[model samples]
Target: MAAAPRWRERLFALYFLSHIPITLLIDLQPLLPAGLQPPALTELLQWYAASFRDPLMLQPPEWFKTFVYCEAFLQLPFFPVAFYAFLKGGCKWIRTPAIIYSTHVATTLLPILAHILCHDFSKAELGGPRTQRERLLLLSVYLPYLLIPLLLLFTMLCNPHYSHTEKRKRK
Candidate 1:
């Protein structure tokens, strides 16, 4: 017999599904002709752009305001699903509050960075022209945020090093 999705699982599924609208909006942004792809590898080529004019203090294009709102709306219901999933799924080892908090932090911060880096494509104006210093800052932060989750996820799945101890009681 197939197992039905638990309430928490159902909620997470919904949260993941809801990302479609945001994806649609993001994908719908104006794009460059095929020839421009190589030079405008970043998000700046579009009518809307994301740039890193400020390092310590980052800003994004106007469309980002709507994007961020959609992101938060997506996340609001997701945290608990992750929490409950951790407890219930036998992956409790990876469910530390710190890890959970980091997940939240990562999700929240990446967009700001992504927006800054891709500002050229952003439809709205954020700030002045990009500088090397701002570029360096964006470059450094980029890969770590992108990589860590994959590392954590891979560890959770492949190696059992991060496993939690949950003993089932005997009848």
Candidate 2:
């Protein structure tokens, strides 16, 4: 099986590395109890919500909270492992886990993207995006998460090195 380019693996490594802080500082903030959340990070999350006009972050519904819980319990733990594997490059063990992680994240983002595109945040009184421009802006913020994971899923499934193992023949 042909190896995937080292640059691709390195790029993925950087992504996993960057996601660690984002998950801790922003994405997981909603799940943390007020007392447990550091004031500075909490303030950062608030700024993100206000600046992005992201109602989901500002007033997360129960369904959104469930996604956060999955991030905390599932995706969060996998970040370090992915970081290591991608950094090392060609750790076949990572393929399955990466496939699973990417699929799960991509799946979660679909509903979120639909909400951003279709929901009438103005009528909902959720302090969400009131205008089409604002909704598009919020959608931009969430789009990368979906795109990157989908890319990873594609790489995992289609990259020969990731999906196929070669047997060593006796000399």
Candidate 3:
């Protein structure tokens, strides 16, 4: 058996650990701010509830058109392409992606965190409970945001050029 890279082990551990509170955050979505009700969070939980492996964006509210537009126009497809180049690309590009994604997460979660920290329930509650259909809808919408960085982090740890078995043999 090949030995694992320290970075890959670390990154995978971090990602796996993060899944817990993220799911909790979903369970507690009713407690988030109106302006940001966990962003793409609802979708994942809904998918789980419905026994779907992959969340699909169902019917979204007309008001959410802006989020769809912005996500499509601004963040999706680009961050990873850029991040992959940096992580797998060579040189020191990790800093850029790290900064950008950290900023993105902060901006994305700020509303809810602020409300919870600020103790403003009225401000935090986005609307109401998550209906089955609504949960499915939210999961689809938020999937890219949740799933993409995961890939970046995973890729950063794994170096295909160095097979795990080879690394072990060398050791």
Candidate 4:
């Protein structure tokens, strides 16, 4: 039962601290109507969409909107759980929230990535950027959605208590 390494705690702190602004910028802002949304927020959203060479921000499907809403609301509860688990280096009661959050990130990211990678250009609702620079920018924005949760999940799995739990199940 040695103390967690300094680097691990620091990494967790970075992850936890980032979620606050991201929750507001990415998760919460789009939930607002055009009238209520801040002009800066609107411009930021437009820039992101445009980076993909997408000229229009067409309405997402109702089911997709519901899914986004669920993702947005879930961030509220998860923020505290993630902060305590990672920043405090505590494993107790963390596995469930970590699993749920990781699962949500995985499930949501997969379809979008698939559509971006696999869909026919003629038929798709979203299209890839026309220029290499925009494509790179798009990847820069999206790569985090793929990497961070996965890295966090890997960090959670690295806990000795989690390893012990697995070991105990084998006995």
Per lDDT, the best of the predicted structures is 2
Q: How accurate is candidate 3 locally (lDDT)?
A: 0.43
For every candidate in turn, the CA RMSD to the true structure comes to: 12.8, 2.2, 12.8, 4.1
Using all chains and alpha carbons, the TM-scores for the candidates as numbered come to: 0.35, 0.92, 0.33, 0.74
Question: In candidate 2, what are the lDDT values of residues 1-171, reduced to their tens digit?
Answer: 798888889988998999899998889877777768888887888888888888788678999999999999999999999999999998999988999999999999999999989887766655778888888899899999998889899899898989896689999
Ranking by TM-score: 2, 4, 1, 3
TM-score, model 2 to reference: 0.92
Candidate 3 stretches greater than 4 Å from native: 1-65, 86-90, 112-171
Weakest 10 consecutive residues, lDDT, candidate 1? Answer: 23-32
Tell me the lDDT of model 4 at 167.
33
RMSD of 1: 12.8
lDDT by residue (tens digit), candidate 1, 47-82: 333343442222434554554454455544554555
Q: Which regions in candidate 1 have their CA more than 4 angstroms from the true location?
A: 1-52, 55-94, 121-137
Q: Which prediction has more favorable lDDT, 3 or 4?
A: 4
Q: What is the RMSD, in Å, between candidate 4 and the native fold over all Cα? A: 4.1
Error of 4 at 152 (Å): 2.4
What tens-digit string does per-residue lDDT give for candidate 3 at 6-125? 465455345434444543455334334454655567665565534532211233334333444444445444444443544343423453554465456445544322322333223222
28-123: candidate 4 lDDT, tens digit per residue: 655678668777877887776756654223345465566567767776667766777777775657766776787688677776665445444454
Worst 10-residue lDDT window, candidate 4: 54-63
